[model samples]
Target chain A: MFKGKKIIVFGDRDGVPGPAIAACMKAAGAEVVLTVTECFV
Target chain B: MYDPVIKACSHVLIHTPSFVRYGSKPSREIDDSTTPVLPAIETHLRSFEEAVEYPPNQVFIGNLHPDRLNGIEQPWYRHPVEDASRYGAYGEIMPEEEFLGLMKLADDFDLMWIEKESAPMIKKSLQAHPFWNNSDLGKIDAAVEMARIHDKIENQGSLPLYCHGRIVGCMHRHHEKDDALKAQVLMENLMAKASGALALTHLLKKSDIRADEIDLLLNCSEEAVGDRYNRGGGGLAKAIGEMCGCVSATGCDIKAFCVGPIYALVHAAGLVKSGLFNKVVVVGGGSMAKLGMKFKGHLAKGMPILEDVLGGLAFLVTGDDGESPSIRMDSIGKHDIGSGSSQQNIMESLVLKPLDRMGKKITDVDRYAVELQNPEVTVPAGSGNVPLTNYRMIGALAVLRREMNREGIDRFVLEHGMPGFSPTQGHIPAAVPFLGHAIDAIKRGEMNNAMFVARGSLFLGRMTQLSDGLSFLIEKNPGRKAPN
Candidate 1:
């Protein structure tokens, strides 16, 4: 699915799969776009 | 949107032998004598009780059949598995031996201990009670039959087992009972279940976390609570939080029918990603109305009884530390109607698009575990594609990769995804089944990533709403270095 798409993950502060997803997506040929952590105010 | 990065993950499975086994038909047939009983319920219960480490003091019975369940058409047909077993050839009551074999299979898949003693209490209390007397002593008869099955297993040198979670609460609905009395009993049951879960939370506090550390509480169940005016988020959540000593907690319900656990995981992941909660407790109580709905089918086919047991489950979803991969909440996908209405579109919106956005391909995942319910329970409806929703989603991922097309999606799914291996219970298919296996794979360095997808049918109400949700697991490659 990640042929040429740019990947991004919007996550809760404690959400999982942050680094692993990024690395896997990168390996699958998608450019790692950004990993933003959604902080609760 | 943020770039997805996974730190660590852990999946744990609590096995119980308390699964129920009864003949399909109410009448005993010659073939029924040949069916072997599997002592799944007994073995699991015994394991829980004998465990040297964590003995469950609280148990949550998720779905049980009160001698009678109210407000349903042909209460016997209420449980799909029971219907399939009685009317269709596909539904087979898991004989005691087969039931134990399934539990053993779970062990092969990495489930820990099974819970034991609870079933005896259930068998003793309700089976022979006047409330369940209508089935011609069917309820108690089934319980006694299952106990006999357990005896056979014990004679074979199998260890008695129980699941790890304590019996905190229970919910029972008798169609014939007074509404007020039923409500009172249900409330007490809920409180007990919540208290049991809370006690576990306290135990957790003494282990690696503290009471104050828990940030979110999730109550997962099929029961839709609230007055006709306001129905959602049952009292179990707040009550559980209060009983467990969690100071800041609000309960929310995740209803995906049986896939509530996966949805709960995804929701918990979102809360964690949003910095809203550090520690989230996801809990589910049991439903008794779901029991023994398939006896006729089972009896006709000479298969074991289909509805044998009802129980609840709970888990602690937290931030991944250095030792485990985090939930990777940022990569989740939702099924909005805008994603398209066809099966293809639904799959794309729920699975493909999210992964594409994450820049991951289908082949990169070691295994795709979605809708892992055992087919014996769901196949009688001629719904051959019961788990096909998940398979189709995975196929869409393959199609997105240009490796397959509409016609090939089915084959692609068969090749990539695991079989439907969960029980017919509501939350069994929820990502819980894959949690332990996924974590173990990552730890063993055998796989680098896996996908956990769960879907729901919000349309069952015919409100024009679509039921859908998706979550994937990206395991850490041991060969890769940490990004500093």
Candidate 2:
């Protein structure tokens, strides 16, 4: 799944991809797009 | 705001039967109310010594197998075999026939079983899902098809029947005999204990390093600290320090999941650059609770079990000396929140930005080692993608460098990257692939610089999650003077 999709957005709730998921998505060509960290008010 | 440097590094070590010698008994816990299970930390440390063939003087930094819990064989999550019983309640115990069938299928198709328990879960889930209810034959047929495809891709070998079978059987029992939520909790707890202990013990064994010498520690694993019911705490850092006799050790957890080790390395490098700490250890423990997950999925797909190993890994990073392969601490790339970028933008920020800052092209580097795991492990999970995420990252980097485009990137990765090599352990996919080879390549003076990258997902908490990462370059003998 890491090919030709010029634009990809990877977002999770707490803003981390556990090593396995990150590696897999990167390998699949997602570029690790964006990481949105939660801010506690 | 941190730069990481690698002064001296150690060879990557692996351990098997890590907690076997601990025996099937619970150790005392700091809290009398909640007893923690002891993981095979000592056994694995001993095995790690053998795997890397390190001399006794090498200082090791890692975690300790918590001495807690009654080594009772909890029906849903007990080791099926006696020898595998020491690592906690979930080292070995899978269904033999089902596991064998999955291995045979993996061998026939070249697939790597990622998680040993995946097969069984798939089977149960599929059986209960509406999709499978429509046509039972279709579901089994789909599983078989997936298994065959996985085998072809991962280059399967003979199955480790006994260990894997026991694991599978235990998992099956967990689901069949216990409540689903309770089973999940128990499984998670066991996995956390095993991963924590393995990584911690392995860290302590490093003679070339010491806990007091390390200013930071990073624990990367698929199992996170928090669950649906509670916030998280009690990671490997503190536990490891206590085990290693370094009571003052301070550290945090880094999650990019499989890519966690790389992230930990980068984080350590950054800390060193910031002058916050002189030494740091990036470590991960094996997930015994996750054993047989892949096999369970395969069984669902009419295949045998494919998982064969259980272990953890650790790396040490120190202030860079101009002479050693230093991790270029300043050359860090990040996908800023405002970078209105697509996937390519994300790739560019995370991969290209750092290279651009360093004025280096992808081809300029000697050999690119990205996610290096055996595909045979993950394919049967219906994850058709090749397991080497790093190779793909390298290929993506090449594309951004104008060497190739999207299609070309795919072709290049397929051509250059190592295929399906790592067991389907969660953190195995991270930069662990390069640890062994990178050290050798640097020692042999074959490569001047290598990149380590790790990424993780934080969405499992049901919050709006995004991927975060860290990257740095390891160079050969930069020749800088040692720190005073």
Candidate 3:
């Protein structure tokens, strides 16, 4: 569904990390521009 | 100097394979069913010798430092050390019988009772340890008859204590019917106190500091020690302190689930930094709830249950002595309530923001200690490798910030991350286990800084959906003069 799409991944340290999400994006034929992992208390 | 430094640390383990059947997960399996027993679970338990030789357990107790783990083969269970000792440089892997004696020594009320036959052996073992004194040895009582123990187990709904498949003692209930004060819960609390005291005693010996020198003690274990009226009312800190002759140390408990140690470390550091206390010790005992948490997987995979040991650790935080590393209080990071719960968000606050403020990058940290649950125990349970996942996440964050090329992400992990060696105990694996190795590496000038990151699953409490996390840096001491 993300084919030909450009994505910016925002991840959590405990949940899905940015790289894992970015990998998923790549797997889905999406271009990843940037990723950031923010801490949530 | 008012800086908070980790003067010394000690890590201990209790080989409580018998107690594994009583863990929350297994216990529930008994209570919720009619069988009241776990079929063939006891057969899979490893003996003390096996526990001592286990590579990860050796790392936990400092017989083998964490850095040495790289040389050891994967599936460490298959590669046991030759002629390993229970006594380690940092602490000891106590036998179940000795730990029970300790539980008796720690008990103030008549909650725990031991069989008379096992008392003498226990006394001899306890006296052989360098940490205890005659006064401490006087506390263990082994005169209780087996009939009383059997009665407690069969009639009073007490929990049976075991060693080598035999009933060695029983823990009695506090109230006739209070579920919160039942023998099982009380036993869990007492185990925490005893294991914690053992670690503290080792800390006193390792640090070469008097127990009375401590001004405050913080209990950061997973057990809740209290009566039914106040179910979670806690004083394990003082209870454990008293057990180890910390007569002058006052204490209380701190709870944030698995992130509790980091939270306690920060609070202890803050207390020392504020000059309110000169010495603060943070301790975490093993969790009964976590033992045998993944036994089904281990049994299915035809491997010995690795979650059979109880872990305990202690750290002494005091003013910088111009030698030991100091905790970088200036770079503390916390997951604010509004930070939002996402992998990206938690990492941003814990790993990025703190380093960002100090003009540092992800690669700057010599090492990162996060959820370090051993892969052997976790992977078979399908939990994946927790520490490896955290390192990858951090590497990903580095890539996101352009601090490193995406192609070098795996290399970053290899350089900065370590293999997980801690047990699957709830709080034990949450980043604090690396403190001992980190301290040594910094003193040896092998590394300059290590960051400890801890994240808690607050949602498990059903209190809120909010997640919790805390991070802090420990770096080589930058000398500062003490006030005259």
Worst 10 residues of 2 chain B by lDDT: B56-65
Cα lDDT tens digits, model 1, B364-472, are: 6666776654444444422243465557656766776696677888666655565554444555456555554455557667666777776655544556434455666
Q: Please, what are the lDDT tens digits per residue for candidate 3 over residues B39-99? A: 6577788988999999999988878877678898877888998888888877889988778
Every candidate's lDDT: 0.45, 0.45, 0.85
* Model 2 DockQ, alpha carbons vs. true complex: 0.07
DockQ of each model against the real complex? 0.02, 0.07, 0.13
| Candidate 1 stretches greater than 4 Å from native | A1-41, B1-207, B210-212, B227-233, B241-250, B256-259, B293-296, B380-385, B404-415, B477-484
- Displacement of the residue B185 alpha carbon in candidate 1, Å: 8.3
For candidate 3, what's the TM-score of chain A, rounded to 2 decimals?
A: 0.87
Chain B, candidate 1: TM?
A: 0.58
Cα shift from native, residue B31, model 3 (Å) = 4.2
lDDT of 1 by residue, A9-41 (tens): 643311222344565677899887885433110
* DockQ winner between candidates 1 and 3: 3
